[model samples]
Target: MIGVDGQAMNRFQQKIELRDGEALFQVGGSVRDRLLGRTPADVDGVLLTPDPEGAGGRLTQAGLAPVVGRNGGRAWRGRGIDLTVWPREPGQPVEEALRHEALQRDFTLNALYSRWGIEEVIDPLGGQADLRRGIVRATGAGALVRDPVRVLRLARLASGLDFQVDPATLAWARAVDPGLAAGERVGREVLAWLTQSAAPGKGLDLWADSGAIRAIPEVAALQGVAQRADYHPEGDVWIHTGQVLDRAAQLGQGLERGALGVLMLSALFHDVGKAITTRWELGRWRAHGHEAVSRDLTQSRLKGWGLGNRVVGWTVRLVADHGRPMALARDGASLTGWWRLLDGHPCPELLFLLAQADSQGRVAAGEGEPSPPLFTAGMPFRAALDRWGQIPMLSGGHLLAAGVRPGPAVGRGLTLLRRAAFLGRWREGEPIAPLLRQAGLLAGRAKG
Candidate 1:
């Protein structure tokens, strides 16, 4: 058994003994973590013995706190420590306590805990063994039945921990009663799973196997659909997705949980429409306009899942332009083509990363080589692509504000400006109004 660290154990033991008369209650995972030789970030405790006098008065008598409940049991100190104290014992044993906590929990792993002083983990339903075995198991018959939110947790743990699900657990999670989980609960849990899992591909597979995928049928359909053998021998659309999901999950650590959350959703949904557009021609499967379909389907799924507007908007942008980066990498893509792809887009680099991961996964499946849009071999093309970020010009909105007539001219002028910038005809910081004027576009005049 790994004993507690120096001074910490002594201090906590002293604190417990000093408060002998008062029942002690701690409300976090620090104890379990400490026993496991892991440094926890939160250490929260409560005085189980009631304070007839008051919260402050009782703490003062124990020489602990004059008013610990001021923050409503939430206080964070140095070293990323967050503490929360409960008012009473929620259940009889640690197992029941876990169930009480599970009422608010979304997954089985998060519900697993141990007694405050006990060395062994109080899995009660064998969560620790499951963790060691790399599988996720539900608590009991009521695990998913009591809270449908747990389904998202299952996905999250599968990815985050790289675990498989027990067949029975998978079956139960699949049969989860809909409408039992609130929209916010579903959104938050799914977002968390997407953002935190270490093997998101596994999570997606679990979701698919459990019927949760059908809840968002558009994404579900991506599985097992054939890809062109010439380009994608990765087995099918599902296998391609799994590769991307695995890569994405490896990126979870220290990531911006919010942005990463959206990125995961983007990655999962990016190829979703390929199934619908799939067609066989000359013994090769082709998915024409799949990118467009994927964007539409992704946005629809995000909205259906009740995701935040910001997440939905970012996801839409990623999905819509996910294929644009390939254009930048492809043969025959001129400076003009590159500029058009980057115009007004904020995340060109991230799009490239996504495209790269997608290409790599595809290549691993013996898909010959990534299709056009990914640079292959051409000195002139390479030079032009390299210079893409250096060029810039005025936007349509700028021309409109300059009194340039709003019409085809706006689009035409913007295109000309971008092209000229790429060709060195328009220098940086040059006023575009004159250029428009040279093109016979009058300021503030709407052309017929």
Candidate 2:
């Protein structure tokens, strides 16, 4: 076990040090975070000892649970520490094991290791210097080829840490075989980057720069697509999407992780259909019915990425109904219209946030500032939703119990009653006979 001169150790560190190992070094993000003066969220340790089995036995004796994986690697978990032993290969020198392990890491910055209770960092791959320079450099040419998921990780690190990718590493990422990475892995990485990063647009920019966006053919098609200059002075569809994503991230800072993910993903693909539906009509750019097209595209792309049904459903709904608020405002839609729109959506608040970001992302022609005219127009409608509850005041069960048959006519009558309630024409707790007569669901009683 390794010991230090004056530094105090936490429980996990103290317990691990009591084992009979040459050294236990804190590795990966834990070491890098400590050097950066940030609190490490998770600490992982690597044990270097000749007796691997002995080390595992000692950890188990200390009450740490052994977690075995499909690959047969053993990891010990306790007190928020994850400890793993490096297995020594047959006929390999023990001295070269550390360097060999370091080379297998995805990036230079993550290859760092620091011995427990010590001030020194083990930099076998020059990771410390790269960290100082704020650069994400791949350890070797085969780094990406070994695990293609590193491509998305490279983008995630660049955005999450606000670091720049080395030019050579970017080129290497572009030249690698795309089929080596699984769609599920890429989707998982993208979701992490979207939800966890301060500015996910930077990660997307890197994805575009590395040519990794081609994995989603629909997203790749967004490049160079034009929008109406009167509304979008931000150049092409891809540029506008990046801007909207950044804006949405800023707007959704305090939201729950799931809501934030939905908003960001919606913003990222809100305009995807422009690539397919854009056309020259009356000598200007127009994308009529693009919202529906975008929704279809979103469903297919997210399904291919292995996203769950709920996420896919919510994201597609957001994309499809993204323009409703503005359209309703333009048409001066009544309270019933707003209620109808909100009734069909899973989360009206998320849709409004996405709409706000969409409105704020555009640079109007001859205007230096981003004008959110639609957001201003939709404010009253949003306030009305808050005044009333999210769901309709009445239900189809009420109509069914009122002697209405369970069929298409009953559904239509319920919708009419809900609309009447929204318009203040119907009151709760009142006799339903009058409303049923108004809805043509009941024969009127002859008055005396």
Candidate 3:
């Protein structure tokens, strides 16, 4: 057992207690985080006791209700932390039980444990050494095969800690079929990879490298699609995806959890349609209508992952409009046009972020910077919109209030007024009767 100094245990005793001959130790990510000199978010522990009822009753008396876990252990959640405490069989020694549990874990670093109060760690598989060296080594050969979901766990740990997976363990992860993992387990890992990890792109690269990306066939299909060399000298669609994911990681820093997750997902699937629409037409590659295709595909995939309708709606909206900003800016379209596109959207800001990530990701080799006007021209419009705050649009009612009668001309007159407003030629609440007549909306007839 190893000892590490930590500060989270000050209220540990006040939170819970154990009966005689029962020992509880802080385990899993809590112990790993403390050993790395980082503060753990929560405390989770395993209790080694033959008397399961007594230990559960003690926790219940301490204001925690116990629920049965998959491993036949009692899980509890309360004011302080979440704990999954396993009971040792009859006549089992503390050392024997701890070692047995340690070996059953997925990774060596995660297998390390520490008792409450003093924080003494019990290492049975050189997990402490691996943690110090920043390596993710599995506990045993059968660990990942026994639970293929550990592949995602490995990816999460590697990305979260910025650690490298040991070669032997990585191979084992690669050999396992990721399809064996449950759907919800896969979805949770996907969320953590994007929302929880600082280097979310690394987690994706790990999935691709370890062959785990096959579990997400939609993403894997991006491996071979091609783009214009001058525009995207970054090899292929998959390579571009990694770069965009990394950029989203930078752009989404400190955002709210749901917003960050949505942005990352948008960046990931913003160009997924390119896989189907790319063709060598007009002497260069083009993915016409890729945004629409990507929007549909992204919706289907997120729904398949069992994401909430709100998340699906937000991500799909971002993907659908992610390409429009640059398209509008390149055509010299008014800022009002951009506003019209996102008028009723949930998160207008994420659209800008998604577009920025996509535009910045496609860089030609040897280029010192990626500033392609073809895609980056609209980035400035985002700041302009923010400063403009929500400008009121000239409605059809305003045109009708003028001399223009109910017809197609009313809609046309309304567009003209909005253009005039955007170009500083008109303002809201200004008299439009004279202007409508002067513009021939009333065929030059004076207003009655």
Candidate 4:
């Protein structure tokens, strides 16, 4: 069932010019995936041969712009294949060199290798056996500590490759400092786990077990935070958050790239504020103004990751308004309130999707999916959107034409006009009135 490339690999083997003792082996995910009956999108190879020009000189001469890492090894990334080559000892036997390279991989499953143009796999650490056993075992005792990124990588592989981590390896992973790895690398690993994994919640549970929680203390703080049993019969804030992420992964399959990234990040941080804002009141717990705090915390976290302003801005707004859809639909709000929800918004659909996921996350044990109204397409959130979208476009430009001076008053006047027009209380061309005086206009305002 291994679908390793044949003719193309044979051509590569002929071009690399292997000497008697030298070898070029396709290694890591490519070989492992091929054995698992999946066509790996990316192929990794290690050439146990040296050239006077450099480790990747053969490939570069064969048309690649390889980069040399700090370790003096060269990595050439091109098309679907990424190859790394390091200088090997003169007259070193291929078996010994391949065994040494295999021992250096982070996990035994990744330690598997296959020679170019050869069908047989050279498993130096019995990675093939571990692969069949569906286990991810460290190649060395110090592997996790040596590269703490492996802890997060385990988060990905847990669901990505559908395998379990060896208990001993998990123990070692839990002791390593996640900060030892680059933050950007950490972010990418986490994003992949949440976005690509079918069970992002379980992957994060593994992450927390591996001490990757040290990477984001905000999330770790959620572990024991309380929620009212009536509304959140499932469990604590952390458990609720996990459920939300898994629901979001299903809900977000329709989204892609920055949009999906925003949804996932919003879902992760949507309830973070509950850790600080939850209070005992009226005989139960309440997070009266958690969304605002969550919005702030989410902004800080996203900025710390050096995310772009557009993604950060949208995610922050979504976090801020996470409770709006259901609340507004049930109790209603000012036209300006709902307008502000979607104002300058790139995608309200994503916001609603995250909100739905948040709502779906909390449930009693053994209960089915939450009922619709909040979950449906004709959701009150949508009605409000339609109403707001139809607001008379008597914009700031129109007011300027009417000779109204530019300032806060002009904006306020416009909002009032829109609010009045939104409820059909005042016509678009009618004289503006005090919307605050209207009976329906002052029901309530959104919390900060």
Candidate 5:
């Protein structure tokens, strides 16, 4: 008899039975997530039938537009449910089909299945036990070798579920050929970990531990790269990056998804240029102009991974300007400086958060205390923007109307005038003509 848990399955089963009397079994993530007390993101089912064509026809005749695959696989995609016919030789028994399908799955936790009206889970691979134990284990021998993409999936599951991978499974993942999967597929897996996991750095650490980081050469190069001890007591660039990424995630808890992704990615790739730009200058390490280098590398690597243009652009901008907030704060820069720093960037708040995280992630040499918060300088700067509004009192157009020629000189002149006003040298009600005259923009007398 169908139970409460099987109500959804009963409806699915009724539809299948009404068409061809075929049995549909729930499987994969749908069963595993539900068993873990988390709402499953998607539901997938397996139709137990030897006649793939007949199953497809029946599903179609039942008014479900099934996406039929070349290998005779069928899928009903709406309502977060997916249905596929079992892969079996013609005339194969349903029991054998179920067993073969479960064995082919990547991880034990994902190889679970349950049928409508059945109280027990159908687990031929001990997936239920693994799920209960909160472990990610391979289904059987050659599991990762069967599909190298599973190596990335292993990291994703570990990060997403906050579970540990079985030692043997990790060993198998380490041994798999990373080149077996294409870059786009591997990128998708890494993207999932970056965007979906609560602690993505842990997933990256697992990937590094499993030697899967070699798949992305850019990230793999971060290992063992030293940093200046005085500024970064965190040992190396790679370790500092992990701390920064986690700190960024913590600081960006309530951020929008796209903004959070950009912030995290910015932290991830912030110091990539340190690997190339590091040099022992005057008996200390220095990475002059690393920001520009890191920005270039970020663009190339993200494009290679096939990320969208918006993401690539936003991440590159963050990487390029990551140090600006800190630098401005240190210099006690005025509102004009802050405005100039945030002029092109759409999310200035995220940049400030990143600066704060970057500051907190570093340690003073031989000290246990956290780094001082440099981003607090943004407070006054933001207050100034809010008080004065984002619009400047004067523009290049004002200079042109004052007889200043339209050229690079006019742009430079207006920049100076704006800085003067932003620094409070010009009062709120003060006329711009006096400032223009003082700057020599006006010829003889100030016009009222």
Candidate 6:
């Protein structure tokens, strides 16, 4: 069934060919998406005719709301399709409009267009050839250098398309000044591009190799700094980070933008501190206390990068608490230990995922044997978490309800009770009565 917009696009295309004696050329991502088998929300059309301005009246007569601003183009929200017009080569028709758009767009692969309801795919810039070859070549070196944002775009296209950038383009991107990219713009684009990747590590490597990684100094510094092979077969903290990013991006597929944003930033900066704290142990290297160091460093970097407080706060929490999972994996750590460590943390699951990714990286790097089975070997790790999820037999809120006065004792009693409960020394269904009695938290329940 042709929907209203599809029908409108059909009608509009035919009328333009008849009245203006010109063909409307669709450009940009709309064309790229169509070739990629995706439906786009809007289409950009370049009109080839003597009086491109008069085409607006005809579109308005066709019952479209024309938005006038930017690009010297009018936006027509009509017949179920939102369309924009870029006038090129007035007094020409059809092919000229297509040619004009191909000349102006940034990348060769993004310049191809499809004729509405026709089987014809236009490729003036060898865009289709680049798409077929899995190559991202710039339309021209001049156009690419005009906007430094293309450097980021080139990175995104290479990752998103899983294509190799042309060597010339890669060379150009590596030498561009960071000042050409506004930090806020880079930040926003990085956050957005992170969503389109299946493996952000590959993307990060591309960024590093292209010098985009150096644009953010703190992250770039992590490269090649070693972590102990006993703990990290993944070679160094930087190498492990790339693997973690790949894992995170894989898991984050289909997640919301906000969730993906958090995950990506967390993956990228999760181990940024290892560059500073690495030291040689008895025989191998170890990054003792790097988790704490990373948390502090990430906070400062995120602030400098102008990231939101919510993102920075959660990422810091994830980085700080990342080591807890390895501790949990150890059979000796008591529930009280786990509970104490996680007492104020947010999003324990995200932390665990990072830990697992870290472990996976180690194993992949031949640092350790594959992790034990999730049921038996992995059970203790999970069981401790499951136990932690249960509320303590008593809390400050519960103590206050039990007639325990609101004082430091109430707070103190809750902590002690929770500690005992976490250790399994406190039984379930037991009220704050016995705990209050023992701690002198209540009059009859305590002695004093």
List per-prediction Cα lDDT, in the order shown: 0.61, 0.76, 0.77, 0.75, 0.74, 0.69
Candidate 3 error regions (>4 Å): 1-12, 61-69, 78-80, 365-375, 378-380, 387-448
Q: Which is better, 4 or 5, measured by TM-score?
A: 4
| 226 Cα displacement, candidate 6 (Å) | 2.3
- Tens-digit per-residue lDDT, 266-340, candidate 4: 888898898899999998999989988998998887787777798789889888888877676566565556767
**Candidate 1: tens digits of C-alpha lDDT, residues 1-448:** 1133435534554543534234433333454345435665555443333332344433434344433433344232322223223333433453454455444433455445543444444444554566567777776767777767667667665766566887888888888854466666666767766665566676677677776655556777877799876666567888888777666555445657677776778788888889889998777788889989999988876787788798898888888887765555655666667677766666655555566557655644334644423323234433655566666645778778777778988888887777787777888766677777778876554431
Count clashing residue pairs in model 6: 2
TM-score of each: 0.69, 0.81, 0.81, 0.80, 0.78, 0.75
lDDT of 3 by residue, 1-448 (tens): 1122344354445545656677778888878888889876667677777777666667776666665544455677664556667668777788788888887788988887787755678887789999889999998989999888888888778878888999999899999987787776787778888787776765777887766786777788898888898878876888888878888888899899999999998987888899899999989999999989999999988887788999999999998988777778777776667657655568877887778788878655563755533445555666556644545655777666556879999977876665565556767777777667777897545443
* Every model: Cα RMSD to truth: 7.7, 5.2, 5.8, 6.9, 5.7, 5.9
Say which prediction, candidate 2 or candidate 6, comes out ahead on lDDT. Answer: 2
lDDT head-to-head 5 vs 6, winner: 5
In Å, residue 112's CA in model 2 sits off its true spot by 1.5
| Cα misplacement distance, residue 134 of candidate 6 (Å) | 0.7
lDDT score at residue 448, model 5, on the 0-100 scale:
41
Per candidate, the number of residue pairs that clash is 13, 0, 0, 0, 0, 2
List, residue by residue over 84-108, the lDDT tens digit for candidate 6.
Answer: 5656554655666666666666788
Task: Count residue pairs with overlapping backbones in model 4.
Answer: 0
User: After aligning candidate 4 to the native by TM-score, how far in Å is the CA of 24 from where it should be?
Assistant: 2.7
Better of 1 and 3 by TM-score: 3
Candidate 2 residues lying further than 4 Å off, grouped into runs, are 1-23, 39-41, 45-85, 89-96, 116-120, 364-374, 388-418, 437-448
What does the lDDT come to for candidate 4? Answer: 0.75
How far in Å is the alpha carbon of 64 misplaced in model 4?
Answer: 3.9
84 in model 6: Cα distance from truth in Å? Answer: 6.4
Using lDDT as the measure, name the better of candidate 3 and candidate 5: 3
